[model samples]
Every structure is written in structure tokens, then in C-alpha cells.
Target chain A: SAVISQKPSRDICQRGTSLTIQCQVDSQVTMMFWYRQQPGQSLTLIATANQGSEATYESGFVIDKFPISRPNLTFSTLTVSNMSPEDSSIYLCSGSGRTEAFFGQGTRLTVV
Target chain B: AQSVAQPEDQVNVAEGNPLTVKCTYSVSGNPYLFWYVQYPNRGLQFLLKYITGDNLVKGSYGFEAEFNKSQTSFHLKKPSALVSDSALYFCAVRYPGSARQLTFGSGTQLTVLP
Candidate 1:
């Protein structure tokens, strides 16, 4: 299992501001992913951050809104751009391993 | 596309009683199933997973899950619940050879009372 560390554990941002959440892993990994958990809802995949390449966004999500960057194998960042009150949610980062996956502590964003 | 379903929203049980959290999934090919637990303000912790071989997979904290392919279900169970076991539980699935993304269930909130 890999140890993932995420920054800005919790933050309060203005409606029009943008926040970038960072994820760092203890070990190098092949795949990294981003997910969002809305209030009282299940997790929804935001995108798959490919190392040295553009992240692949899931349906109902777009790159313009959720820009992701994976410069290396052990680190990635997800930026919530032009946030709104609806953007308030828990953002999580995950890394895939040989058998299972591991998750970071998660960033709780509150848009006001 | 792969998806997971956890029917119950919340489950209440006594500390000494057995606890079960139901999960079902749908996948095009063989599925990789997993169970994760989350304490408040914490990351999701991997409990157990069923890749192949065994029908019963045991994991951390004396938790086990039975995979019934015929019924398309993988239910998490523990012989005796503990007060500390009260948390949010999630069931997730992915196609072994597909994308690295996981489809998670709605999550089940377990409350173990002493």
C-alpha cells in the first residue's frame, strides 16, 4: 500500500476563486485519480491523471472546470477553477497499486 | 461501465452482535471487488479485496467478505461488532483490465452501540 498525503485538508474559498489541491505519494505509481464527494452522496470520479500527459475527465466533468496535472509518478494536483457554492465537496486523490488502490486524506472545500 | 450498489443507508447493531453490510455490482467482465472503511475526517482505509481464487476474503480488523458471483453480491461481515467499528463503509468495483477508476457504492453508515 502507498501512503498518500494531500494538502489543504480543509479550506474556505470565495465563490469566484480557484483552489489547487496537491497529492503526494510515498512511492511511485502508474495511475493516479481524482474523485469528488458531494454532501451526503457517493464518490464520483473527476479524472485520471496520467503522468506527463493530460488527465482524462469522466462524463459530466470537463477539463476547463477541473484542471489536473501529474508532472511525475509520485505527485499530482487538481485545481477547481471558477468555483461556485455547488463546488463545495470533498476532493480525494487515489493511486492504483498491484491489487488495490490507496487514497489520500482528502481536501474539504467550502465555497461561500 | 462498472458500478456498485450498497442498498442500505444506515445499519445499527449491538457491539456483540454480528454485522453485515450488503453490496452488489455490475460489470461487463470479471470484476475486482473491494471494501473500504472511513472514519470521520479520515481517508478511506482499505479493508479487503476479492481478485480471484477465494470465495471468502478476510481483511483487517477481523472483517471478512463473501463473494457470490452467481448472485453478484459481495457482503462484508464481522462475527462481532465493536463500538470503534462504527463508521462509513463503501463498496467499490472495477474491471481488472480496464481503466484504473473505481465505481463506488453510495456508502453505508454503520453504528455499533455498546
Candidate 2:
């Protein structure tokens, strides 16, 4: 298990605006996962961030809408571009080892 | 592909009584199952996980889960329920070749009446 944290515990933004959430892990990990949990819904993986390479987005998600960046093994950032009301959700970042995965505190984004 | 399913939307238990939250999963290969609890406005906390060895695995917050390979189910249990244990619970699973990316269930809201 690793200590993980996310910046801006929560934020409220207007539609058409974008926000970037940062994820920090205390220790290095091989792979990091990004997920979106809509209000009162299940968690859906947005992408898998790889160190020194582009992220692999899941079906129904795109890099243009949810761009991801992993500069290193311990940190990554996700940007929700052109936000909409439907984009209001908890953005969670997770790090994975060979066996288990650990999550960050999460960023609660509310789009108005 | 690996996936998890939490059949119940919510479960209610009386204080000091045993509680169970049911979960089932599907995977192409062997499964790695996990349980997590989330309090209101808080991040998810790991409850327990079943990797390879034991059918019953214990984890933080006095929570434990049993893995039933035949039925492909993993149910979260607590011997005695507490009011503080009321929260949203999630079941997650990952299979080989997924690189440890877990697929989480919708979640089960558990309420312990005092």
C-alpha cells in the first residue's frame, strides 16, 4: 500500500470551463489508474497512466475530453476539458503494484 | 475482462447484529477481489482483499470477506455491526493481464441502526 493524495479536495466550476486534478503517490508504482465516479454511481475507469508515455483511455472516454499526463511513476494529472453538467463527479486517481491497487483521496468536481 | 457486481443497493442491520453485503464477480482468469468502504464526503478506505491463499481474508476496520470460487462470490461480513460502520461499500475485482486495474461494483449502502 502507498500513501496517495489529490489536490483541490473539491471544486465548483461552470460549464465550458476545464479543471486539472493532480495525483501524488508517496512511493513509485508501475502503473497508475484514473477513474470517474459519478454522483451515486459506480466507478468507471477513465484511463491508465503509464510513465513516460500517453495514457490508455477506456471505451467511451477520450484523451481530448479527459487528457491524462504521467510525468513519472509517482505522479499524474488529469484534466477534464470543456466540462459539462454531466461531468460533475468524483475524479479518483489510483496506483497499482503487481497485486493490489491504492487510491487517492479524490477530487469532487461540481459543474454548474 | 474482469468485473464485479454488488446485487443489493442497500443493506440494513441492527446494532450488534451480524451484517453481510453480497458481491459476485466475473473474470477471464483468476480473480483478485477487494472490498472498500466510503464515508460521506470522504475517500474510500480499504476494507479487505482476497488474493490467492485464504478463502477468508481479514482487513482493516474489523471487516472481513470470504471468497467462494465455486459460486464466484465474495461477501463482506462483520460479526457485530456498529453505527459508525454505516457507509457506502464497494466490491472490486481484477484479473490477470489487466495490470492491476480493478473494476468496481456500483456500491452497496449499509446502514446500521442503533
Candidate 3:
């Protein structure tokens, strides 16, 4: 299992502001992904963080709203742009190894 | 597209009683089933997974899941429940040839009573 570290474990941001969450893995991984868990809801996939290319966003999400950067195999970041009250949720980063997947502690964002 | 289904939204059990959380899946190919536990305000912790070669697989925290191909189900189970086991549980699935992104079901909230 890979050890993932995410920064800004909890943050309060004003509406219309943007906050960037960083994820660092202790070892290199092939696939990295971003997910969102809304209040009292299950997780939704935000995007796939490609190592050297643009991140692939899922339906109902776009790069303009959730831009991602995967500089290398061991690091990635997800930035929630132009936040809103509805954007308040827990953001998690996950990495998949050869056999299994692992997750970070997650960042809790509250938009006010 | 692959999908996962957790039939129950919440399950209540008393301590020392066997507990079960139901899950079913749909996939075009061989399925990789996984169970994860999430505590309040925390990320998911991998409990167990069924890759292949075993009908039943055991994992962390004494959790085990049985994979039934005929039923297309992988249900998480524990012999005895504990108050500490109160948490949200999620069932996830992935196809072997797909993008490797896991499709998670709507989680089930498990509450264990004293």
C-alpha cells in the first residue's frame, strides 16, 4: 500500500475564492485520481490526474471548475476554482498500485 | 460501464452480533470487488478485496467478504459487531480491462449499539 499525504486537512474559504489541495505519495504510482464526498453522500470521481498531460474530468465536472496538476508520479494537486457554497465537500486523492488502491486523509473544504 | 450497488442505506446491530452489509455489482468482464470503511471526517480505509482465486477473502479489522459469481454479489461480514465499528461503509468495483477507476456505491451507514 502507498502512503498518501494531503495538505490543508481542513479549510474555510470565502465564496468566489479558489483553494488548491495538494497530494503527495510516499512512492511512485501509476494512476492518481481526485474524488469528492459531499455532505452525507458517497464519493464522486472528479478526475484522473495524468502524469504529464491534462487531467481527465468526469461528467458534471470540468477543468474550469476543478483544475488538476500531476507533475510527476508521486505528486498531484486539485484546485477548486471559484468556490461556492455547494462546493463544500471533502476532497480526496487516491493512488492505485499493482494490486490495490490507497487514499489520503482528505481535505475538508467549507465554502462560506 | 461498470457499477456497484449497496442495497441498504443504514444497518443497526448490537455488539456481539454478526453483521452483514450487502453489495452487488455489474461489469462486462471479470470484476475486482473491494470494501472500504470511512470514519467521520476521514478518508476511506481499505478493508478487503476479492481479486480472484478465492470465493472468500479476509482483510483488515477482521472483516471478510464473500464473492459469489452467480449472484454478482460481494457482501462484507464480521462475526461480532462493536461500537467502534460504527462508520460508513462503501462498496466499490472495477473491471480488469477498464480505466482502473473504481465505481463506488452509495455508502451504507453502520451503527453498532452497546
Candidate 4:
């Protein structure tokens, strides 16, 4: 299994501001995904980040609101734009390989 | 659309007793089933997966799941429960041969009491 990590385990931000969450993997991987877990809810896929290309957003998410950057196979970032209280949730990153799926610690964002 | 359903919102079991967490899925094609566990403030950890071959798949932390294709269910099981097993359990599924994405169940909180 791969070891994945995310920076700024948590943060509190004011509404209208933006916050970028970073995810790093121990090794290069082919599949990297982002997900959002709202309060008392199941996780929802945000996008699939492809190295050197644009991320593929899921049905309810758009690039404008959740811009993603993946410069390489082991690193990616998700920026939440124009934050609102509703944006408060835990953001998780996952990487998939032939054997197992590994996830990062996750970033807990609180928008006030 | 592909989706998973964890019938029980929570499962309570006494330590040293057997346990089972039920899961059912719906998908257009054959599904790749997986079970994951999450501790408080921690990332989801891979428990086990049923890609092919065996009907029973063993995973990390002494966990196993039985895949019943006829019933479209993959329920997690353990011979003996532990207090440490208390956590959120999630069942996920992906369509066969597709890296498209995984559909997750609502999740079940498993609490093992001493």
C-alpha cells in the first residue's frame, strides 16, 4: 500500500476567501482522486487529477469552483474558491494502483 | 448508475463475539467490491476487495468479506470483535474493468463493546 499525506491537516477561513489543500503520495501512481465528505454525509467524488492535464470533475462539481492542479504523478492540489459555510467539510485524496487504494490523512476545512 | 447500500446505520457487537456488516450493490455490469474502515480523524483504510476468483476475501486487521453474486451482496465479517474495531465501515463498488470511479455506501458505524 502507498503512503499518502495532505498538508495543513485543518484550517479555518473566512467566507469569500479561498484555501488550497495539497496531497502528496509516497510513490508515483496512475489514479489520483479527490473527494468531499460533508457533515454527517457520505463522501462525494470531486474530481480525478491527471498529471500534466486538467482534472475531470464529477457531475455536481465544476472546475471553476474546485480548481485542481497535478504537476506530477505524486503531487496534486485542490483549491476551494469563494468559500462558504457549506464548503466546510473534510477533503480527501486517494491513489489507486494494481494492488490497493491508498488515501491521505485528509484536510478538514471550516469556512466561517 | 452504480451504487452501494449498507443497510445498517450502525452495528453493535460484544467483544469476542462474531460480527457482520451487511452490504448490497447495484451496477450496470459486474462490480468490483471493496470494504474500507475509517477511525476517528483518520483516512479510509483498505480492508478487503473482491476482484475475482474467491467468494471469500480476507483483508487487513483480521477482516473478511463474503461475496454472494446471486444476492448482489458482500458482507464484512469477523470471527471475534474487538473494541478497537469500533469505527466507520464503508462499502464501495466500481464497474467491472472501469477506472471511472467508485460508488460508496452511506457507511455504518461499528461499535464493539467490552
Candidate 5:
């Protein structure tokens, strides 16, 4: 099991600004993933943070909007660029293990 | 492509009663499934996973989930509900052959009323 620690547990940001949420895993993992959970909604997959190359994004989500970086197996970051009120949500990061994946506490971003 | 659905948004169960949270999956091949629980003001914690073999899988805090292939369902169950068991439950699925990431369900909020 890996413990992922995410920075800036909760932050209120102004519109048009960007916030970068960092996650650090206690051990190495094969893949790192990012997700978004809006108010009263389920989680949506943002992207898969690859260690060396560019991240793999899901449909409706683009790299420019949610840029992800995985410098190593145990570290990754997701930046919410050009924030808006709609972008206000909880951003969570997870590390895929052998069987079950572990998630971080999540960074709650509120854009006003 | 691959997805899981938790039909119910909210489930209320009285304490000491059995509880079930329904989840269904749609995929091409075999389903790699997982269950997670998010307590109030906390991150998601892995409850259990069903990769193969066992249909009834036990997990943390006396929680268990039954995997049904015929119905394409994996419902989380607890014999005796506790007030602390009240939380948001999420079901996740990974494609057996191709996909690298897990598709998550919308999530179900469980309330174990005292």
C-alpha cells in the first residue's frame, strides 16, 4: 500500500488564476492518476500521469486545462489552469498498486 | 468503453440492520473491480477488490462485497450496519485487457441512522 500526501488541502482562489496541487507517494507505483469531484457529484478521471512522457487524458478533458506532471514514480502534480467557478472542485490523486489503488486526501479548490 | 454505475445516490439503513449498496459494470472482457469508502471529511480508503476467484470478498471494518458475473453486479454488503459506516461509497472498474486507468462510479452516500 502507498500513502499519497497532497498539498494545499483547501484553497480559495480568484478566477483566472491557476493552482498546482502536488502529490507524493510513499513508495513507487506503476501509474499515477488524477481525478476531479464537483460539489455533490461523483469523481471524474482527469488524466493518467505517466512517469516520463505526456499524461493520457480522458474525453472532454484536455492537457492545457489540467496539466499533469509525473517526474518519478512517487511524485506527481496537477495544475488547474485558467480557473473558473465551474473549476471549483476537489482534485484527488491516486497511485495504482498491485491490486487496489490508494488515494490522497485531495485538494479542494474553490474558484470565485 | 468501460464503466461502473452506482444507481442509488443515497441509501438509508437503520443501525444493526443489513446494508447493501448496488453497483453494476459494463465492459468488454473480464471485469477488474474495486470498492472504496470515503468517511465524512476524509479521503477514500480501499475496502476490497475482486480480481478473480472469490465471489464473496471480505474487507476492512467487517464490510464485504459479492461479485456476481451473471448479473454484472458487485454489491457492497455489511451484516450489521454501524453509525460509523455511514459514508460515501464508490465502485471502480478496470478493463481486463486494454485500459490502464480505472473508471469510477458516480458514488453512493450511505447513511446508517442510529
Candidate 6:
């Protein structure tokens, strides 16, 4: 399993502010993804971060709202734009190898 | 679309007793199943995975899961429950062809009482 590091383990943002969370994996992985999870709730897929191309968003997610970027195999970023109190949740990033996907510590976001 | 289900929202067991968290999945192809545990305010930690071969797969923190193809289920188990084992457990599946993105279950909250 690769070691994943997420910057700014947590943050508190104003309702109209935008915040970007960064995910870095110690080793190169074939797949990278972003997810949103409310505390004590199941995870919701945000998007598939593709290297050198635009991300593939899930049905409820969009580039204009939750933008994702994967510049390379080991690094990706997810930015929450036009945030609102409803956007408050824990943001996670994961990378996959041959069998399993390993996750980062997660970025806890609180919107006020 | 691939999907996973954890029928029980919560499961409670006495300490030192065996424990099981049920999970069932639906997929178009041979299933690649995984179990993960998340402690409060923490990231998900991989427990075990079943890709092929053996039906019973063992993983971290004294946890194991049995992959029953006939039932389309992968249930996490521990021989003896510990208070520390209590957490949110998620069952996930992935298709190798679909960029291997995971489809996670609703999650089961396990509480091991001492």
C-alpha cells in the first residue's frame, strides 16, 4: 500500500469562500479519486481525477462546483467552489494498486 | 452500475465474543470485494480484500472476511471482539475495467461492548 498524505488536515471556511485540498501519494498509482463524506455517514464519489486531462465527475458533481486535478500519478487536488454550509463535510482522496485502494487521512471542512 | 449493501445499520456484541458485519454486493462481473474500518474522526483503514482463489481472506487488526460467491456477500468477522474494534465498517466493490473506482456500501456501525 502507498502512503497517502493530505494537506491541511482540516479547515474552516466562510460560506462564500473556496478551499482546495491536496492529496499526495508516496508511490505512483493507476487510479485517483475524490470523495465527500459527512461525519458518521457513507461516502459520496466526487470525481475521478485523471492525469493530464479533465476529471470525470459523478452525476451530482460538476467541474464548476468541485473541481479536481491530477497533474501526475501521485498527486491530485480537489477544490470546492462557491461553498455553502451544505458543503461542509470530510473530503477524502484515494489511490489504487493491484487489489486495494488506500485512502488519505482526509480533509475535514467546516463551512460557516 | 455496481452497488454494495450493508443491511444492518448497527451491530452490538459483548467483548470477547465473535462478531460479524454483513455485506452483499451486486456487479456485472466477477466481484473484487474489500472491507474498511473508520474510527471516529479518522480516515478509512483497509481491512481485507478478496479478488480470487481462497474464499476466506485475512487482514489487518485481527480481522477476516469470507467471500461467498453464491451469496454475493463478503462479511467481515473477528474471532473475538474488542472494544477497540468498534467503528464504522464499509463494504466496497470494484470492476477492474472501470478504472477500478470503488462502489461503497452504506456502512455498518459496530459497537463492541466490554
The prediction achieving the highest DockQ against the true structure is 1
Off by over 4 Å in 1: none
lDDT of 5 at B45: 89
Q: DockQ for all models, in order?
A: 0.88, 0.76, 0.78, 0.66, 0.77, 0.84
Error of 1 at B64 (Å): 0.4
Per-residue lDDT of candidate 5, residues A49-95 (tens digit) = 99888999989999999999988888999999999999999899988
**Which stretches of candidate 4 lie above 4 Å from their native place?**
none
Which has the higher TM-score value, candidate number 3 or candidate number 5? 3
Write model 2 residue lDDT over A1-112, tens digit each, in one string.
Answer: 7788898899999999999999998775678889999999988999999888889989999999998999987889999999999999999998877777888889999999
Q: Which lDDT tens digits does candidate 4 get at residues A63-107?
A: 999999999989999999999999999999998877457788889
Predictions in order: lDDT: 0.94, 0.90, 0.93, 0.91, 0.90, 0.91
The TM-score between candidate 6 and the true structure equals 0.97
Cα error of candidate 3 at position B28, Å: 1.5
Ignoring the other chain, what TM-score does chain B have in each prediction? 0.98, 0.97, 0.98, 0.96, 0.96, 0.98
On the 0 to 100 scale, the lDDT of residue A71 in model 6 is 89
In model 3 chain B, the worst 10-residue window by lDDT is B94-103
Residue A47 error, candidate 4, Å: 0.6
Residue range A1-112, candidate 3, lDDT tens digits: 7799999999999999999999998774689999999999888999999989999999999999999999898999999999999999999999987657889989999999
Q: Candidate 2 residues B12-91, lDDT tens each?
A: 99999999999999886788899989899888777888989889999987889999999999999999999999999999
lDDT score at residue A16, model 1, on the 0-100 scale: 91
Q: What TM-score does model 1 achieve against the real structure?
A: 0.98
Q: How accurate is candidate 5 locally (lDDT)?
A: 0.90
**lDDT at residue A77 of model 1 (Cα atoms):** 98
lDDT of 4 at B75: 99
Ranking by DockQ: 1, 6, 3, 5, 2, 4
Clashing pairs in 1: none
